[model samples]
Target: MRPGHDFIGVGVGAMVFDDDGRVFLARRGAAARNEAGLWEFPGGMVSFGETLAAAVVREFDEEYGMAVEVGALLGVSDHILPDEGQHWVSPSFAARWIGGTPAIREPGKCTAIGWFRVGALPEQLTQASRDTLTAYRKKGPA
Candidate 1:
């Protein structure tokens, strides 16, 4: 794949929910590939031959320093960063925090991590991230 531009990178995001029904979010660092400095879920591009669920679980641990129980596929949306010339097909999941506290392991790509109630999400969010959360909300808290 070409990566950015015309390539549709396959991505996976973990909507890690705590017992209180709040979801984890990470602030994208200024040095991120696209849509930098925006709030988004912890995830990355899915590698070739990897399943979406496996990818989400792996990415959550890699980005947030925690393992998660990857649950249902909440939604899918296109992340088209026109100004940055990038595109991605992102599949977002409803995951449960299994272990470890959320931490920004990769400082270059992420700056902070925190849990937020569904109704109190950050205003500046990646379009795909926003869409995913909206989809999750439509289903209501379980």
Candidate 2:
């Protein structure tokens, strides 16, 4: 049995900020597990025994070939996608860029990647990411 479809999945995300404070985002590809075609805070499913913080850090490195320093928790989101028949508990965090240039390491999962000012983000966003952003905004500082 597969995750998400067979059982609820757990994922981790990061609102990684660059030196200029722009947040990094990735557009989901057709093969994305859910919420394809929408933009989101780059993240992925967590492996067994993996801490959420470590998952977020690994996600950035694996998905974009970048490094990030994980910080305070943003919030936990109940990502229920009825249309896609998938559900996930997503915990997101605030992180800082450590180094490395962003690159799409998984073309099947991500179509485009970029840094955007928080004020001007892509119009279409995944629910999990939207929730994370809302939580982050409410959080303000560390």
Candidate 3:
């Protein structure tokens, strides 16, 4: 077993897609922790007492000022940024937009939020988020 491997964290993420197949992405702020200025789906760390779905819903509200109805589980991916000394196993979900428009509620963490067509996403997407989108495109809904 690897030393220091005992410590690890699990996170949950969301991929909110609209009726026209556009996906919501938010740009991180430059001064914020983790992938700052990079585009990614809205989500965050799962608290001790929250289920994955609940976590996503909470995160969506907190980050984008929106209410999302999370649907099926899309997939999960492991992200380890050795250079940043961060490791996480993130379970991502597919969310259906229910209400509220995207806004930069967490100004310190996020700067902007918008929907982009699946085929033409922003190039600054976080690697894990990109992987999630790729998988989503390949699977093309249930």
lDDT of 1 by residue, 5-120 (tens): 66678888878888888889989897787888899977888888999998888888787778889888888988887788888888888889979977788899888789998788
Instruction: Using TM-score, rank the candidates from best to worst.
Output: 2, 1, 3
TM-score of each: 0.93, 0.97, 0.89
Which is the winner by lDDT between candidate 1 and candidate 3?
1
Model 1: per-residue Cα lDDT at residue 130: 91
Tens digits of lDDT, candidate 3, 22-132:
889989897545778899987887887789999999988887778999987877877776876677777888888889877888788888888988778889987669767
Candidate maximizing TM-score: 2
Query: Is 2 or 3 the stronger prediction by lDDT?
Result: 2
CA-lDDT, candidates in order: 0.84, 0.92, 0.80
Candidate 2 residue pairs in clash (backbone atoms < 3 Å): none
Worst 10 residues of 3 by lDDT: 1-10
Model 2 agreement with the true structure over 30-118: per-residue lDDT tens digits: 88898889999988999999999899889999989998999999999999999999989999999999999899989999999999999
Report the alpha-carbon TM-score of model 2 versus the true structure: 0.97
Model 3: lDDT to the true structure = 0.80
Model 3 misplaced regions, further than 4 Å? 1-6
lDDT ranking from best to worst? Answer: 2, 1, 3
In model 2, which range of ten residues has the least summed lDDT?
Answer: 133-142
